[model samples]
Target chain A: MTEKIVIGLDGTDTGERALAFAKDLASKIDACELLAVYVIEWSPFTFQTAEENERRHNRREEEINLAMSRIVDPAVEGLKAAGFKATGLVRHGDVAETLNKLTVENGGTQIIVGRASSDGFAKRIFGSSTQNLVMHADVPVTVVA
Target chain B: MKNFVKFGLTAAAVTVMSSPLAAQETPGIDERVNEAFAAVTGPFVSLIFAPFPGTEFPWIVMWLVVAATVFTIYFGFVQFRFFKHAIHLVKGDYADPNDAGEVSHFQALTTALSGTVGLGNIAGVAVAVGIGGPGATFWMILAGLLGMASKFTECTLGVKYRNEYPDGTVSGGPMYYISKGFKELGIPGGGFLAILFSIFCILGALGGGNMFQANQAHAQISGIVGDYPGWITGIIFAVVVFAVIVGGIKSIANVTEKVVPFMGILYVGAALVILIVNYDMIGWAFSQIFVGAFTGLGVAGGFVGALIQGFKRAAFSNEAGVGSAAIAHSAVKTKEPITEGFVSLLEPLIDTVVICTMTALVIVISQQLIVDPATGNYLLNEAGTAISTVDGNTGVSLTSAAFGASISWFPYVLAVAVVLFAFSTMISWSYYGLKAWTYLFGEGKTSELTFKIIFCVFIVIGAAASLGPVIDFSDAAIFAMAVVNIFCLYFLMRVVKKELSSYATRLDAGEIKRFSH
Candidate 1:
């Protein structure tokens, strides 16, 4: 059976490091496939005015397109060029939840994510997405420093 | 620095000119401004509020009631049958993960709710019950219930005929549905009605949405901080509103979206506490409502009077059939236009039926509205208005007094909530007005900015002026919107029925996904 690995992309150098680590691990494993996923952080509970709500769909699509072109698509292309089977997924939702859901759907054996810089007080109190994934992800999570 | 000095000097001159001491010497600036506005707006106000021939009822209220009733019947009591499904839609049980839009059904409802759930619930209900007696609450609840079908019809058509621009931003409201739905049905005069509706929408946004809100927010603040020049409060409000609109400050909008709902909950929570504490009076309050609704409790016009106030306030509060909520609901991410309509019906139930009723009940039970024991009627003053225990306070003050009587500290919290409510309403209506303005003048930054500046200016004018002509003009403009909107709803409702039937068929066939357990 093929081993599927899910890599979280944040469009940063840290994400590149996580991808590199996953790629190195994939080379060691036989019949491995890599999935590059970019999750746009979104919360449904926030209030918006009529105009804001009207524009939100367009904005979400723009963000997804931008993420696909600038991060996920290039990474997937690089992986494919380097002789690895790779794909891309972009979605709007909680970062950890989207990542985990995608992994479960794809039957991913492991999830890899970069350790995003934790700077804000909210992050300290609520814990980072990496922490959340580590705690709740069904598959093994590899966190790159 | 030079511009700041110039602005400061100009403000100081206006402040001294309009000061109370200067007013004591002669007719004040406030009086002059009020008189000027009253003169210009008087005839229009009279025309709008004109009693139906040989009756005390205003034709506009009749227009709204007839439309709501027709919609309710035409849809087979949709508000009652689909009420549970509406809740399911709002909860995202049927939300397809692949839906195109970012706004969930819940967000659309709250956004629209914040707009409609302002002074209408707090002060408008007070005015309704104040004059109409407790009986008005009964009609208000009934109107709110029927108004759900009105919202459902307009919102479904709103989504069906919405303008999806090349930029991906969407615009939809009565204007869109009236014009597009009519055209699709091969009807004439749709364009004329659309233009007329836009004009009324702009006026309604400026008057009822901007001015009335500012006026009430100023009144509440003055009640708390002791009387002062309203222009001071007006200028402050104008500056903040200008920042939110012209400065494109998302943070302010974000903060308002977060805080106003919290305040709404806090206001309702306090009302619930008072209701629980006065549990013995609940039955008595209901009796008063029922009795007043039918008998008028010695109010000037009696039964008809209570019915009028109840319908008027309910129409104004929930804004069902008014088409503004349609604009907000049009943005929801649903392939089925009827799904948004289902979600939109919950608005009136929350606004008038629940919140406005709570305000009315609190006022009734607090003993603020004094009643004569012998006559079993509310005691009337020289003007034939109900006399309240708190110095015969009316509007927001009466509401404040009612809550204050129960919690003592509630008036202060209420004052804060009133200001926030006013601010949020102003923001929402600014967009509504801007949409109308753009429809007339075409979409561009200059047209948008002109409306924004005008809206902000009206805020100051609203806060500074007395209730007299400002409120009259506000009511007139808002009802005028209903007149044009409901007229269109009558014609376009068939399209909505079609959408509803299709949605129901698909839903029954299990074509619609249910994501929740």
Candidate 2:
């Protein structure tokens, strides 16, 4: 049976480190696949005007396209060029939940993400995605420093 | 900077045009302008408000009531049956994460609510109770309840018949549904009714949506500051409004969307405070509303007058059956159009049954209306308007006085809220009017700009004009929308019924997915 690892990408240097760690871990094991996922943070609770609401569908589409092109695509391409089996996914939702859901659906054995250095006030009040994933993931969550 | 320069130039031009009237002392330019407007619009206004033959009630009010009743019965009280589901939809419990669009049920409902819950709730309720007596409140609540079904019907059609462009933007309203639904049914004259509905929507957007908001906003501001030329207020409002709509200032529109909802909560919170403080009078106020609803409490025209005022204000406030809210709700992201229909029923409940009732209760509890001890009827001045304790203050002023009597600082907060409400309503209506404009003239940059400019100019006119002609014309234009919209709704309600039963069967069969616990 192939071991599947889900790597969360933020299009940042920290995220690249997490990818490198996940690739290193996958190489030691035969028949391993990497699933790169990018989640755009969105909340349905935000209020919008009529005009804004009208344009929101298009805006969401634009956000998804930008994420796939700029973040998920590059990571997946690099993994493929390195002769590793990899695929990319982009979605709009809370970051931790989307990543966890992707892992479960894809039968990923482990989840990997980078530790973001900035712990802002909001993140403290509402735990960071990494913190949430570490606490709640069904599979083991590997946090790369 | 370019937008600012353009806005500054327009404001300067408007100020220059209005200065002559401000400088002149003869009858004042405000009165002269109002008189000219009244003269032109008088016949149309009278025709719209014309009483039914051998009856004092305006046929338009009855038309709305009857349509609401029909929809309520036809849908088997869909508003009541699915009301709990509506709340769940808004809470996103039934939301599919993979829905094609981005707008949630909550956002759609809030956007529609913001448009309907404006000056109509603040001032319109005062006018209802003031003229129709406390009994009007009873009828107003009933109209709100029945109107929910009308919203469900129109909004279902709004989503089902919506025109989704290749670019992903959608447009839907009475015009789209009337034409498309009628064509589907092989009905003739759908084209004519669609065109007529679009025309009425544009006029209603300009009159009730634009001018009435501007006029009442000026009234509130002038009440706070000392009396000044209304054109001054008009020009300032016109400039800000012009900047948002014409100049494409999304920042202003964004701020307004966020702030207005907060203000709505603040206004309601203050009303709750006042209601709690006047807890002792709550029973008396409700009893007055009940008795006045039946007896008219000696109000002129008795029970019929209360019924007329209640129906008229509820239609104006909740905008159910008016077809404007359908436009707002149509953009919601849902494959099942009936889901949006269910969500929309909550609009009238919030706008009229809850918020408007709060305003009415506050006015009654404040003891603002002077009741003659001998006759038990409200004291009427020479002009026959009810003499309130606040020197016959009407509209927002009367409402402000009622709140102020309980919370002294409330009137100040209310003044700010009123201005914000006016600005937000104007912005929303500009979009509705522009939709109708584009529907008629075809979509293009120049056509859009022309309508925006005309809309801004009307804001100035709305602010400058007196209450009489502005209110009359506004009422006429809005009811005119109901005339076309409700007629089409009768034809399209079966479509909604089919959708509702399909949705219900799916839910009962466990086909509908619930995303959250």
Candidate 3:
């Protein structure tokens, strides 16, 4: 079985690019699955009621589902439409922690991310979290600019 | 458009020439750095204790770390208790848009972060990791967390002691806090302490905050741009910084308030993408940092013992007691002193906890560590010797190379980030130094103009020169501020307690509410 390719999305513009790349790669590989993972962060203070909290949780889940539907599902559906196997996965926690965890849990072999075109002063004091992960990830990380 | 075209053309040329250039290259970059560092690493390793003094231990770092810790403990870890409140202060429950201050809590926070978060996070960590090891990250985080308390103390004092000009512009910082806050506390030594801190702040403004920031940036740009001496960086930076800084704090803050957030989001967002793509490495990163903190292999045979590397870096990262953040915090618009203190908590959280953590993790897990650890002893590219000192580029380049190992094109990403980080920091520090300059040199036209001229000139020198000596003195001055400021906090901290208790009472009464949804 060919390995799977996963594209992690944080609902940013670059994430959309990563999703497209993952879908194309899934098709190029003889046998591959595409998994979409999202990590949801919830502050313990925000929810005062269980019923309300349940509604909120469900709302967040739906939001992730919709995002997946837009960014990942279209790509996944496109792969399927092209006769390839692809899936979606989403989780929740701190961004770095969640993404790292999801990549390990999912059977993802190679992961893809994005970089920026402008390398101005903004990139300096504040580093690119995606770039940091790609640099240090144990697995093969392909960064798509 | 021309530069863009030129950049593209040049990039292509470098790629095409990489092989031939490598084969026929004659090296001239044999300038040595960290000489004191080398002395410490060799015969001085035992009695001298640390791997290097200023490069590693430096009395300034020692003082800053000590003060930050003392403030954290004395304040009863208030940084944690008031974390939410700090968030709200920026949300501005009490923020009057009609206030006389130059910026709001959020703008103030961003401006200050621009100053505190600079090349230090990148190269400073690299240096600490180079000398101290991965363990340095553990300390850096600890320092950043505790540094929040120090930040709180200084910022509260900043608001407590700030001044308003006749025309209604704001002038504040550690000078006001020390000279003024101390007097309000009925301390006899208030004037002296304020003056001392002002001196330190002035030194810090010029050295660490301004010059050091510009110096490292110049090194990085020149480092990557190739064949160009660092001076070219100085020339460009001098022009840009001089033009902007001459406009004073209003101009500086206006640009920073916008620039800081966008850059912060951009950099952190990029780091997130990298982490997600390389998610598996996260576990190993945590393991190494957690373990490295306990072992001495990171720094290897330091008299101070294990994890000093971590402490040194942490101390550098958060800059809790250094008093630089206070200058920015002083400008916050509020009558209630504690409001700005709450907002100040985010400094270490963003600069130290979030940003520094990401950089540390990246460096730790990079394949480069597979080759050398602790930013330990430089390896000469040609002869492969373990030299104590390296070319200036080694500090930042080490980090870039580690990042590039995973993302082949990541060096450019980091380079862009490095330049921005340095640029924002330079601007922020410029404000800090200006405040100090005005404090010492009588806030007149000539004082402002003269200080500015020198500051701009330093920028060029910083960019063009080798960073070794420039950074050393600047680093020293920053530490000195921490020493003086922490002493005042120790004596006058009861005032902070009263303020905190009163604020807590209001919070309990539900008088303090979030500003908006």
How do the residues A14-112 of candidate 3 rate in per-residue lDDT, one tens digit apiece?
777787777667766776777666545432222011112113324555656676776666656766776766676655444454566567767678777
Instruction: Give one digit per residue, the lDDT tens place, for model 3 in B121-167.
Output: 77777766655556667877887887888888888887787776554
Tens-place lDDT digits, model 1, residues B1-517: 8667546544543443344334444546566767777898899899988999998889888899999999999999999999999999887788766662389999988999989989999999998888888999999999999999999998898888899989888999889988988898899999999999999899999998998998899899999999876766877887777767776667888898889999999999999999999999999999999988889988868889999999998988998988888888888877788988999999999999999999999999998888889977788878775554458688999999999999999999999999999999989999889888898899887788678877877777788788767778888888888888998888888888888788788888998779865
DockQ of each: 0.66, 0.67, 0.01
**Candidate with better TM-score, 2 vs 3:** 2
lDDT of 2 at A116: 71
What are the per-model C-alpha RMSD values against the true structure?
Answer: 3.4, 2.2, 18.3
Off by over 4 Å in 2: A117-119, B1-27
Off by over 4 Å in 1: A12-14, B1-27
> DockQ for the candidate 2 complex?
0.67
Between prediction 1 and prediction 2, the one with superior lDDT is 2
lDDT of each: 0.87, 0.88, 0.64
Candidate whose TM-score is highest: 2
Relative to the real complex, the DockQ score for model 1 comes to 0.66
Candidate 3 chain B: worst-modelled 10 consecutive residues by lDDT: B384-393
**Shift of residue A80 alpha carbon in model 1, Å:** 2.9
- Please give, for residues B1-517, the per-residue lDDT of candidate 2 as tens digits: 8867767756654654465445557657777778888998899899989999999999899999999999999989988999889989999999887662389999999998888889999988988888888889999999999999999999999999999998989998889999999999999999899999999888899898988998988888898886776767777887788777866778998898899899999988999999998899999999999999888887877889899999999999999999999999999999899999999999999999999999999998998888998988787666675544457788888899999899998888998888888988888888899888998999998798788878877887788889889989999999999999999888888888889889999999989999877
